[model samples]
Target: MRLLFLAVLRPHTGNAVTAQRVRAHLEAAGHVCVLKDAFDFESPSEIANLILAENFEAALALHLYRGGRLLQGHRIPFGVIFGGTDVNEDANQRDKNTVMGRVLEEARFAVAFTESMKEMAHAQWPHAKGKIYVQSQGIATTPNAAFNWNTFLQRSEINQSADNLHIFLLICGLRQVKDPLYLVDAFSEWHQEEPNVYLVIVGPEVDPVFTREVKAKVKRSPGVRLIGEMPQEDLHAVVKNCFVVVNSSVSEGMSAAILEAMDLEVPVLARNIPGNAAVVKHEVTGLLFSNPQVLVLSAKRQNDRIAYSCLGA
Candidate 1:
C-alpha cells in the first residue's frame, strides 16, 4: 500500500527521527511510504492535492494539530500519532485543542508513546479513548567508534581530564517547551563547587529567537556549553560516553533521548514531570527531580555513588 506520513521534520528533533523510523519499518514490510514535513505545506488543500497526485492509499500523522489537522477534509483514511506537544502544550490552547478534537474524530486510530500520554489525550478527548494505543518509543544507538572525547571536551572549553570529568549531556531542541535554561543558574553554582563537572546541551537551533536568548545566558553562565546539533550517530556517541543524560523539558509525550540513554545503560536525570515519571522509576530506571535544587542534589548523589564505586574498585 502507498502511505503518506506527515510529521515535523526538523533536523535532529524527535518527531523527525520517529517519522523516518516508522517510514523505514513500513517500507521494509513492502509498503510504500511518502514522508513529508507538515511545516512545508500551509493548508489542507495542499495535502489533499498531494494525496491525489501521489495516489496515497492511507495516511499517518505525527502530531494531532500539526499533521492530523492538515490531513482533515481529505478523503483518505489516516491514523494519528501523538507528538510531545500534542497532549502537553497544544491541548491547553483553545484553537489547537478544538482542531485536535476534530482530527481525533476523523482519525481511524491514534498512538501514544506511553500509557500516561494516552490517558492525557483521552482526558482531553475522551471520544477517541478506545482508539488510542500506547506504544513506547523505540531507540537504536550507534556510537561513533572514532568519536574523540578529549576533542569534544577541548572544544567545549571544559578544562578537565577525561577520566575525572563528569559531563551531563542534555539533549533538546532550543524551544520554550524544552526549558533548556531551567538549570543554568543551579548548574553554574554547582560548577563552582565541582570544577570537573560540566553541563553540555546539544541540539538544533529550533527557535531562532529563543536560541539567541539561550546563547546570551549560556555565555554568562560558566560550566555550561551549548553545542550545535550533531548527526544522529554522533549524538548517540556522545550519549554513550556522557556520565549522565538529562532532560529538562517543561513537557514531553515521550523522550527518545531518555529511552536511548537507558538502552545504552547510561544514567538518566529528568525533570519530574508526568511524562518523565511514567518512564523513570525513581531510583530504578533513572532519577527524577521536581526542581533545579533537587536536580542538583540528585546529580551530587549520583556523583558520590560513582566516587564510592571507584574507591571500592
Candidate 2:
C-alpha cells in the first residue's frame, strides 16, 4: 500500500519527528510511504489532487486541524493523529473546531497519545469516539558517545561554569504557543537568589518574530540563554547532562522532550496543562508546575536535594 503522510514539517519539532517515525514503520512493513508538509498545500482540494497524483492508497496526518483539515472531502481514506496544538489549542477555537469536527467525522481512524486527549475529542465530537485510539509515541533516544559537555556549554554561550550550574533544559521550537518566555522573569529572579542555576531554551527558530523577541529578552534577562537547535544525538547527550528537563508550553498533545527526559532518567519540570499532566505524575515520574513561581521553587528544591545527596554519598 502507498500512503500519504502529512504533518507540520518544521525541522526539529515533535510533529515532524512523529510523522517520520510512523512513516518509517509503515515503509519497513513494505508500504510505500510518501511524506509531505500539510502546510505546503493550501486547501483540501490541493491535498486531494496530490493524493490522486501520487496514487496513494491512504493518508495519515499528524494533526486534526492542521493536517486532517485538508482531508475533509477527499475520496481517499485518511487517519489523524492528535497534535498538541490541535487538541489543546485549536479545539477551543470556533472555526478550527468546526473544521476539525468535519475532519474527524470522515477520518477512518484517529490517534490520541493520552486518554485525556481522547476524552476531550470524544466530548467535542462524540460520534467519532469509537474510532479514536490511544497510542503513545514510541520513544528512542540517540546516545552520542562523542558529544562533549564542555563544547555544548561553549556553544550555548553561557557565562556560568558547567561544574556548578544547575541547568534546566527546555527543548521546543521558538513559538508563542510554547510559552518559552513564561518563566524568563521568575527564573532570572531565582537565579539571582541561587547564582548557579540557569534555564536554557534550546530548539530551532520556528517563529521568526517570537524568536527575535526571545533573543532580545534573553539579552536583558539573567539566568536564561536561547541556544539554537542541535542535532538529535547531541540533544540527547545534552538532556542526559541537564539537572532536569522543562516544558513550558501552554498546550501540548504530548511532549517528546518530556518523554525523552523520563526515558533518560532525568526529572521533568512541566506545565500543569492536561497534555503535560497526563504523562507526568506529579512528584512521581516528574514535577508539574502551575506557574513560574512554583517551577522556580520546585526546581531549586530538587537541585538542592540532588546536591545534598551527592555530598552525602
Candidate 3:
C-alpha cells in the first residue's frame, strides 16, 4: 500500500530520524511509504489534497498536533504518534489540547515511546486510551570503521590531542527545551581539575536566538565546545569514540541518541526526567544526574564504573 508518513523533518533532529527509520521499515516490508514534512502544509485541507492527489492508502504521523492535525477529517485512517512536546508541553495548553484530542479521536491508532508516555496520552484523551501502543524507538547506527577521530576534533576547531580524552558528547539542538547549556559551567569547572575531560555539545542550530546564546556561553565556558550538526553516520562514529553520551534535554518523547549510545555500548549520562528514566536505569544502564552540580560529580564517580566499551574503538 502507498502510505503517507508525516513528521517534522528538522535536519538531524530526533523526529526526522524516527520518521525515516519507520519509513525504511515500512518500505522493507514491501510498502511504499512517502515521508512528508508536516510543516510544509498550512492546513488539513492542504494535506487532504495531497492524500487524494497521491492516492495514499493509509497515513502515519509523528506528532499529534503537528502531523496528526493535518490528517483530521481526511478519512484516510492515519495513525498518530505522540511526540514529546504534544504530551509534555502542548497538553498543558487549552487550545492545543483540544485540537490534539480531536486528532486522537479520529486517528486509527497512536504510538507512545514509553509506558509513561502512553499513560500521559491516555490521561489526556481517555477515549483513545485503548488505541495507544507502547513501542520503544528502534535504533540503527553505522559508525565508519576508518573514521578519523583527530581530524573530526580539528574540524570542530578544538586544539586538544586525542590521548586519554574523556569526551562527554551532549547531543541536542540549540533550543530552550533541549537545555544544551545545562552542564556547561559544571563541566567546565570539572575540566579545570581534570584537563583530560571535555564536554562537546553537537547538533543543528534549530533556533537562531537560542543558538546565539549557546555559542556565547560555550565560548566563555572552558572545556565545553559546541560543534555544528553532523551526518547520522559520522555522529554515530563520534559516539562510538566518545567516553559518554549525554542527554540534557528539558523534555523528550524518546531520545534516539540515548538508544543509539546504548547500542554502541557507550555509557550514558542523562538528566533525571521521566523520558530519560524510562531507558536509563541509573548506574545499571547509565548514570542519571538530578541537577547541574550532580552532572559533574556523577561523571567523576562513574568514570571507573563503566560496564561496556565501544566496539573497535
Please provide, for model 3 over 52-111, each residue's C-alpha lDDT reduced to its tens digit, 9 standing for 90 to 100: 899999999999999988899887788988888889999999999999999988988999
Superposed model 1: Cα runs more than 4 Å off: 306-313
lDDT of each: 0.88, 0.86, 0.87
- Which tens-of-lDDT digit does each residue in 1-313 have in candidate 1? 9999999999878898899999999999999999999999999999989998999999999999999999998888999999978889889999999999999999999999888898889899999979999888877888899898778878889896634788888999999889999989999999988888889999899999999999999999989999998987888889888888889999988889999988888888889998899988777677888899998886677675742331232
RMSD of each: 2.5, 2.6, 2.5
lDDT score of residue 248 within candidate 1: 97
The deviation in Å at residue 271 for candidate 1 is 0.2
TM-score of each: 0.95, 0.94, 0.94
lDDT tens digits by residue: candidate 2, 227-288: 88888998999999988788999888889999898788777888999999999877767777
> Of the candidates numbered 2 and 3, which has the greater lDDT value?
3
Superior by TM-score: candidate 1 or candidate 3: 1
Question: Any residue pairs clashing in model 3, and if so which?
Answer: none
> Which candidate's lDDT is highest?
1
Ranking by lDDT: 1, 3, 2
